[model samples]
Target: MPVRNALEALTMRPTRFLLSSWPWRSLAYLTGGALIGITTIFAVLFLLAAGVVLSVLVIGVAGYLATVLSGVAVGRLERWRMRLVDRDELPNPHRHPGAPGLRAWLMCRLREQATWRELGYTMISALMLCWMDAAVVYAAAVVPTMLLFGPVYLYGETSLWIMIPVAACTPVALAVAAYPVTAWAGARAAMARALLAPRSDDSDAKLVELSRSRARLVDAFEVERRRIERDLHDGAQQRLVALSMQLGLARLELADGSPAATQVTAAQQLAKETLAELRELIRGVHPKVLTDRGLAAAVGDVAGHAPVPVDLDLRLTGRLPDAVEVTAYFVVVEALANVAKHSEATRAAVSAGVRGGRLHLDVRDDGRGGADPERGTGLTGLADRVAAVDGTVALSSPPGGPTLLHVEIPCAS
Candidate 1:
């Protein structure tokens, strides 16, 4: 297996590990940590001193604030430097400020748990961990090199036998040093990751925002559908009704059994059919009954039009959220349409109620049940629509019997 980090490199065969670059990377990591830690100590001391000296002035507050925020910069730099020993990327735990000003940014940072965690890590790294890192590097590299040069360092002071043995053991000592260096580096990176990594609450917040965004889009689309439905119902449907009346009157004025009378009669019939089709199209766009009444009435209107016999068992009390109602209504409509087209069932049933702060819906059919969502049926669309409101779809279909589609949408009635 390939080694992806210092800790994983420890699992390799001894010879293979010694030949790899992990030891050098580990050395670099420790060296960088030592340097950063020493610098942080001095920087923090300077800030503290300045804040004390300027305590009587407004600039002292700036110094104090800078000291508090210093960990943010250290955290960012350390996360980047961690790449030497840990190949995985560390996400910034801090969130973007809602406002653009520096004051807003500072307030936001101060209010976050991650900010304090970073500050604590910063202090620990400077006071303890960095010193340990420096010691590890010194013992691993400097001591081994000194022992390897034993002959040169002790040419006349020590016996030839002692020097020879000491120099001969240099390679073994250096190989052993790699283990401690890599181990310490890996441990330090793990500690840093635990302190600076993004929290679970941050992920939850993002998911909530994403859900709200999808709901907003669904609401916008519903509004457009209502607008189009209104246009068809009030504009084109009215014109068609007037044109049908004019054609009827013209047909009465023509000579009996004449071509003009026949043409007018046919035009009147065509206008009437067109008007009926337009009304259905308007309902499909957005049913007015859904707005005027509630989900129960809207669903009843749809179930009444289903080709197969539909049994409704709705038990909703008042009204649900507009999005929930719209989504539930469409789910029933699509399920019945699927029953008519694919289920081949003579009878279907729809039951809905609000339970435990959730709107529950079950559409079942006693059809030859082998419905496949992958068959380009409307089931996928049904699932997508429910998902827009963070709802769930559950389907049960066996090869020889009944099929059931269960949906749940969250709402406050």
Candidate 2:
């Protein structure tokens, strides 16, 4: 019964309607504005005082250190206050890079824009908090009292003006109810703006630079692949073809069955082995199976080879771009390889599906697991490969439990 009521409250239309009304909404907005003003003022003043004390403690040398510390402290405090008032998650504080020497450190600290801005916000917040606290008290208490008492004092009659106090008390009472809600919402918005919003034009510039870098990397990779293909075809392939011809000639000469014929047979066998090795190397460079069969068939081949039992649940119909397919196939192959090599689990499940126009892949193993990114080079390589294609890879493996790898790659429509 209690659960049903709670669920109904979650979907209560009338409650939402009342909250969304103009008068109530306005009161909520005003209250939130007041709380932000108050909090910011308080933060600013506190930072200023702390800065002064630090300056006095270290004098010239300590002043720089103090400023840097003050900035970090202020940023964290503001974020904490935001969480308390607004229930918003904020980004972690940015750390200043450590300099080689004391002078370098001091210079770097002084040069940071965040330090000055945080200090300024702290000073401003202190004054604002004090003023806003007073305003909120007046709005919540004095305004209602005055409205309730004003009419009786002015008219000396409680008949017609009796309703005046009630009318006046209405807004004030609403304001009182709105105070906390306003503070919470405003704090969330301000915190998001301050902590999550890009602080400078450089962030946008960096993104542009990153996109250009990715394009260049892909172009370079294609050029390198062409060069490798040419090398393999002209150098290794030609040598292997000549070797095969030599082996055939040797086999024909070995038909006599003399001691020299036995030597010829050995040479032919060696040549055949060399040719086979060359073919395997070329396949490793870029498998034709991956291109001809698509990601599904390639991944299924990988699953079939796994030492552990693998349940593949793939629903891919058409082909993705060559680059995307190769990347997806390799990601699965590497994940399953890890499962087979590291995960001592009895069974594993691999699933692939398209969701939100992106190819999603998941591999799970029920094994004794403690997979850490820092400990493995295979996972790191896989991560870089996925990132090259603008994909994301996530791994979760707790000690003595199941390990799961999730990957998502954007597909061109």
Candidate 3:
């Protein structure tokens, strides 16, 4: 069974929850909060003192920067501390640094809304939140513990008989109060996350931001692919050509029937094969024709290289976004590769066009069906990449022949 956190445990029956560790966790959370509150008090005072003293000198800017940095630390600390009662991950709202330098990072953090909100949390936590947490814990826990042991201390007193019965009911009373105690502590942590993390309005914005980041990553990946392709084409390919020519020259220098001449000929054949494989690798990286032309030509070129005969029918009005093109091209490549590797078919067909402002692709093969994405990462990866661009993939395969994979990606021509 999954262990319930404080908030989850609160939803259980009072008797069951009391038997769990939530009450103890609540107490510990409050105790830790109180300690952190005291630490924040000292930290704030130190920052203020340092700021004032440095302002008297000329380098007050450093002290102000340190204050902002302290707010960042407090925000991160609260995120960590919130795990005491919260089970959900709290995403940091701070933007990444645009450049690689301490000044840039500091400026980015200071400019974020989270930084100011964290500073407010630091103040509130120090002034009131921790005290409130401690009060609830004391009322729910410490008082009950004292009451449960009241008769032990009051033994032999005249009121011992009366206190004993009331003391025995402390367990029931504490269990009843444990619900609100757990709830209040959870609410406080939730409030801290609300203040120190990204606002809920930005949840959809996070998706858009994620899409843009993925696009940037794809662009960087394309750039790196082109760089590698250029290196192989210009460096290794040229050397292989040179080696093949030198071997041919050496063969000519020896007699036609000589053993050294035969060995040189075999070496020349090996060099040519290696050169062909290297060229294939370069094309797989990112074809030059794809960059110069578009996705139609790129898909056709890849289909041409497939061992199985492939028919290509791709039509487009014009160029699409680079990210869309790259994603579509790779998806087709992987699909065709899976077809050639797993599909026991003699032929495959690739068709692409745009419909209703969405690029449509269909790769069909006359192979035995039963392709399961759960069995392989190829289809799953393709679907994920397509979804990253607001696209969808549909696979139709049964226990018979002919499997069809259709993909639609939104793009403006």
Candidate 4:
């Protein structure tokens, strides 16, 4: 009963229903069949024109705008048709508004190749619709008429002979065969509409640009590090060594004399100051602890000094490549610094573990959290650092809550 009722409902509105009983329901099939054949031919022609025209224009902005608009138009038409004939709800296309002022908008439009292509598709759709309308009428009329009249003609011609019966059966067979062809046409039209739609090319270009910029920055950082190391080794390191030798000689000379003792004490003080400065400079270049003791030891040194209570769970066992270890250490250091400064949370957690051939680090704090990547230069630098090594960084901090900073770096690389 329900199946029959459903079939009846489908037939009642031929314009909206896709499946229905034979004869009375054939109109919907005829309309869809016509649309399919016409739209296919039109879409191919439009796409070809778009490709050729865009090549000639070569004006990126104008081409882009035209392509986008055309895509939108085609997509809207497809959705409208789907809703009316197929009773399917499709996603609406999103259109982004261009910059203000006519010149700016025009410039943007000219650059876009996709817009022109879309426009080409729209023109094709119009032509296809006209052809489809004609085809549907022809198919609907001829098939049903043949079914009804073929039997009468057969009887008249052969006078109930065996061949008459065979000829009478042909019309029904033809009508039945048309159903599948109609469905196929409807599906093909939907697909063509989707293929001709506009999409953003800027996102892909922007991502590539970002990756290259980050790589350049990382290379610059390495160069600066080497420069600093050379400065410490050649300039300050040599000066400190000379100073230490002078202090030793002064101490030997002043072993008994009071005036000599005072000179010795002053020399010792100067040497101590120089050594401290040299250690600080070396640490800035690259922490010796990181190279010698590994990331775990370096992180431990960071946690010990952090203003807030830091719970560290570092489980990385084997030594990673120098670059990876350095990056991982800094990510934690920066995250912890942020937690201490901003995250008003009383407690923070730092964890580093190697899993699935990748290094995963997480720093979380329970504080009055409102961490913004855009506002903070530290976080931005951290992002660049991670990105330099083809790694990823994620930050989650909402107002009046905890903040979580997650970093992942490939160990093999």
Best lDDT goes to which candidate?
A: 1
Error of 3 at 196 (Å): 8.1
> What TM-score does model 1 achieve against the real structure?
0.86
Q: Write the per-residue lDDT of candidate 3 for residues 73-190, one digit (tens) a residue.
A: 8778778777777777788877677698998988777776677888888889989987887788777777778778888877877485698787988977787777878888777887
Q: Clashing residue pairs, candidate 3?
A: none
1 versus 3: better lDDT goes to: 1
The root-mean-square deviation over C-alpha atoms between each candidate and the true structure, in angstroms, is 3.2, 16.8, 5.9, 16.3
State the lDDT of candidate 4 residue by residue for 301-411, as single tens digits.
Answer: 888878999998999787987778888888887788788777777989899998998899999999987888778739999998887889999888889878888899988
- Best-performing candidate as measured by TM-score: 1
Task: State the TM-score for model 2.
Answer: 0.47
lDDT of 2: 0.65
Error (Å) of candidate 3 at residue 96 is 5.4
- Least accurate 10 contiguous residues by lDDT in model 2: 1-10
Question: How close is every model to the real structure, measured as TM-score?
Answer: 0.86, 0.47, 0.67, 0.44
List the candidate 1 regions with Cα displacement exceeding 4 Å: 158-169, 232-281, 372-376
Residue 193 displacement in candidate 2 (angstroms) = 19
